[model samples]
Target: MTWNPSDFNNTSGLHISPKDMWIPELIIHNAVGDTYELRTSNFMKLAISSNGFINWNTGGNTETSCKVDISRYPFDTQTCHILIGKSSSLDYELMMIPAAAKINTFLYDENENGEWELLDTSVGYHAINEQMTFLKCTLILKRRPLFYILNILLPVILLSLMNVLSFKLSINCGERMSYSVALFLTFIVLLNIVADEMPKVSKTISFLQLYINTQLAIGMFITTISVFLVHSTNSKTNDDVTGAVHAVYKFCKLCSKKQQVRPESPKGDDQHEDKYIKSGQCEKLEMEHVQQTPGSANAETNQSPSIVDAVNVIDDTLFWSFLMLFVLITIVFLLLCLF
Candidate 1:
């Protein structure tokens, strides 16, 4: 509201105090689409300063809803606007000076908000419509990621690493599948928590959600691998052992025999066996027939696949695969956050 307090002054060169006169207080226009819920009453306190200067204070806080963009999440910045103006133009005419020197922003308690840092503010005139002009204060906020790093990200990364390490657990332990499933459930809970914190809009996905989804995929992969390994490692009869397992066992046996033989033996028919042994494939025992045949240990065909060996092979393979995948994921996410 705008008014000249001197209008009530006497023509006899007498002074008039604003304390004895009425000063209009500006109120927010209701027709604006974006609005805030005031935390205090609408009544304002009028102050009559020296020289008949008048000042009105409408001190309050607003709990308004803002459009949230969580694509960067822990490293994101948000801008919120607060509009103020006359509620109606019935009794008074309002005017404003568009000068940056007239505006002042001073927060008494800046440290009250721990998660968000006040970056800066922007003030300007916003035309609500042809009939209304509003003063808008735009507040820019940045999220402080230190707390989230210590509390949320650390635990999630450790959980993923633990899941990778679970591949080392023996199939005979009977806890491999259970451990993987437990980690998978934990990932689900974390993902849900992240989703709940965000607004349900069709914007870009958050970085935290991307990481969580990748971890969930890794967990499911480990669980499936565990189930397959346990099933393959638990076969009681050698008849059920597939050709793949037989091939692996024979290859391993050949490598062991090649390591045992120090001197170079004859290279007649053993030449073919030498190629397979060197290439880590099945090697024919030619001159080495005098030595103990790997198949003779069990009195069956060329070396049967041992359950313990098969389990170990699967565990070793999964451990390396999961580790490499985790490293790749970490690099990709770090680059995303940095850029």
Candidate 2:
């Protein structure tokens, strides 16, 4: 086999030499159709003008196998042009053609007009465009099991576990509110991260969204319960209040008992304190009044006698009323948590 160097014309001001001439073979593999479209811009030429181009047609090619030779002349640049046809009837709308094509490079050289000989081989792929040459490959529409476990499942499980902490903290103290606020903010951060990842499309709520919303609602409930419990605890009628109520009742009863016996005496000294004075003179004066007026005696006998009895009755009633109120509140809270 012999190599030929055809004569070339140099219209531009440049010397045409033969010593630095070499040909590089460009091979196409996994061609899609009977004819593939190959543009001349893909080739690398050493000594040719940027505009100097060639269009070689690979006519009558097979679907699976095809080859072309370009070793006739020492041209600075070489490019091939061909058209490819589709053979299958399958829908190609969803198919990505550019992702399927892989390319490799092979070097060939000639020594003193001998046949072209292979030197070395290299493997690489043609990029879709210059901007896409260094693209980072990523998977689409397929959920990576490991990523789901880490990003979605793990976070949701951790958030749910945090909710259980609410039960440990006392509802009347700051622990409930503080823990709830912290968990709520955590859910907000996770929600924001999830929102950024997903496309803004209107549809059913995602699993992650449902999880976050549930956690938020639980936190809100915990906060509300904490507030209610604090209010209930603080709203108690303590011993001082009960004592004051009993004292009021006793004083009213004592005043009524004394008014029945004693005349309306405006000149009396400290009537409230004098009414409580246990003196024989007051008792004799009350007896003389009762004997003179049978109606007064009947009224005194019909009326409840002692202030201490009235105080005891009032105290018992208040104690039972507050106990029932506390019990009702506890039952309601229990029902809410159960359901």
Candidate 3:
């Protein structure tokens, strides 16, 4: 707080209220350390007439670019400083004093601001060599997590789940790759939005940054897996293909065979025998054809590119890998941030 009395005779026993007298102009100087910008405004007011004197009050809300420590991020605390002093007058010519009753008597209530809660306020004197002393007020604030949880964390988590679900799409379709790429781009855009809210300086890695980086890496990995799955469909089923691709074809054939239903035995007599004889003849002809070209049917099925036999294998592998990574990253982030 600051004030000045103009056109007042201190020698006179009569009082001179600011409302009745011309007020003096005073300017404040930057007395805090050189780490923040000076951001404040001043409002002057006249006080009630007193016994033999009058008083004037001058001060206003200040908002500066305070240095932030985001190690805890949504749970962080910050201290900001404000200084009030005469700009042109030295200590010998003019002095600053704090009101005894008002200093350090204020308590901060919770949820007063959306993102930050005022925790404490303090008053002190900062001396500059032997020429000046400035009154400084320091405010302590803590972040409120409700806003960020609703805005940032929840959306990223949903995006991560969407990325995992992308693997369920058919690798034969081009939409699989396109969908995954779109999700990856969405994650990047959300991360950029978050970056805009953070300080430009990188004194320490924030927990939010770590979470975003982990999610982005996961998205990239998912995209890479999708690309590989798409490429796997273009491979031929010849013997020149790798053992892994052959194993994938074998697995697909086994799964298909398990899904096939066996025909039931006939329950009747003479008609059944006739039908059985005809079926036996057909089976004998099929066996002769198989003998002529041993593995032709299996080879033809494996060589078909319309259906990628290896895609299911790739999709299942990627799903489990992504799940484990997601769980591990979440646990670590929780331990580091909430604990």
Best by TM-score: 1
* True-vs-predicted CA distance for residue 20, candidate 1, Å: 8.4
Candidate 1 lDDT tens digits, 167-203: 7887789877888899999999888877776678676
- Using alpha carbons, what is the TM-score of model 3? 0.62
Model 1, residue 185: C-alpha shift (Å)? 1.7
* Predicted structure 1, TM vs. truth: 0.68
Which lDDT tens digits does candidate 3 get at residues 20-77? 5554334444433343222222234455342434566554443445677887676678
TM-score winner between candidates 2 and 3: 3
**Across residues 1-339, which tens digit of lDDT does each residue of candidate 2 receive?**
121233334343232332344222222334555334322223332344324532232223334332222121111012222223222222232222333322222231234323222233223333444332221221111122445457754675566566544555543455656776787788778778777765454543454555556666765665564454444435555422233444555665565565586455456577645664656756777778888998868786656433334434443443344345435543543344233
Highest lDDT, which number?
1
lDDT of 2 at 204: 33
Q: What overall lDDT, based on C-alpha atoms, would model 3 receive against the true structure? A: 0.68
- TM-score (all chains, Cα) for each model: 0.68, 0.32, 0.62
Candidate 1: stretches off by over 4 Å: 1-43, 48-53, 88-93, 98-103, 128-132, 199-202, 243-305
Question: What order do you get sorting by lDDT, best first?
Answer: 1, 3, 2
Ranking of predictions according to TM-score: 1, 3, 2
